[model samples]
Target: MNVTICVGSSCHLKGSPKVIKRLEYLIAQHHLEDQIELSGSFCMDQCSLGSSGVCVQVDHVVHSVTPSTVDSFFQEYILGGLAS
Candidate 1:
């Protein structure tokens, strides 16, 4: 899985650094370091759409991700996606 996080100005203020940290920890905790590839990107343009959290792209599909949503987001998107 390729996880792309938005590090643009909007997302940086929204806590992109924490988001990146949490994801990295989760990937390591779950022993998915080999399967998951994490990366960064510029603006995803979701902020203009009024999305609540930072934008994260798993593969190519985009999703809003906040610090609060990190765990669940990891469970459903990363772990769950790997399940199937």
Candidate 2:
């Protein structure tokens, strides 16, 4: 899985750092370090529409992600797929 978190000025202000930290922890917890490719980008062009001012791309799908939503996002997109 490829996960890209926007680190633009807007996203940074909205707490992208926290989101990144939590995701790192979650990926480690699940032992997906080899399967998941995590990265950061300057802008995704979705920041203006994001309620949290942070945009994340999981594979090719863009989502408005915040630190609080990272857990559910991981569950649904990461772990959920593994279960299936």
Candidate 3:
């Protein structure tokens, strides 16, 4: 799976770093290092939507995310059939 998290100014201010850290830890904890490709990007065009400015794209679907939401996001999208 390809996971890209926005690192634009808006996202950065919203805690993209924290979100990235949490995701890294989770991916390692679940031994998904090989199955997941995580990276950072700039401006996903969702920053103006409010809520957490962090926008995560898993494959092609995008979702507004935050550090606190990483675990649930992983369980539902990364580890579950939703991703497949």
Candidate 4:
């Protein structure tokens, strides 16, 4: 699966960087670095919703993400798929 994280100006100011790092670490922990393609996006137009925070794209589907729920997002979308 491919994961695209938004770290644009708006997202950076909100805590997107931390989210990215967390995902990176998770990928490493689960040995998903090879299966998961991770990249940074400029923006996803969700910033207007207060911090907009971050966006995560899995398998071509883009989901509006935030720092608060990023862990669940990864567990449910990224790692969950691998387990199943």
Whole-model lDDT per candidate: 0.90, 0.85, 0.84, 0.79
Error of 2 at 69 (Å): 1.4
- Residues forming the 10-long window of minimal summed lDDT in candidate 2: 45-54
By lDDT, the better pick of 2 and 4 is 2
Candidate number with greatest lDDT:
1
Candidate 3, pairs of clashing residues: none
Model 4 misplaced stretches (Cα beyond 4 Å) = 49-52
Judging by TM-score, tell me the better candidate of 1 and 2: 1
lDDT by residue for model 2 (1-84), tens: 789999989999998999899999999998999988999999888877776647888888888878788889889977776666
**TM-score for predicted model 2 compared with the true structure:** 0.90
Q: What is the lDDT of residue 65 in candidate 4?
A: 69
Per-residue error (Å), model 2, residue 66: 1.2
Using lDDT as the measure, name the better of candidate 3 and candidate 4: 3
Better of 2 and 3 by TM-score: 2
The 10-residue segment of model 4 with minimum total lDDT is 46-55
Runs of candidate 3 with Cα error greater than 4 angstroms are 81-83
Candidate 3 lDDT over 36-76, as tens digits, reads 89999989888766365588888998888877787888788
Clashes of each: 0, 0, 0, 0
After TM-score superposition, what is the CA distance of residue 38 in candidate 3 from its true location, in Å? 0.4
**Residues 14-53, model 1: lDDT tens digits:** 8899999999999999899999999999998888642678
lDDT of 4 by residue, 1-84 (tens): 778887778778778788899889888998888999889989777667534556667777777667778889898988887778
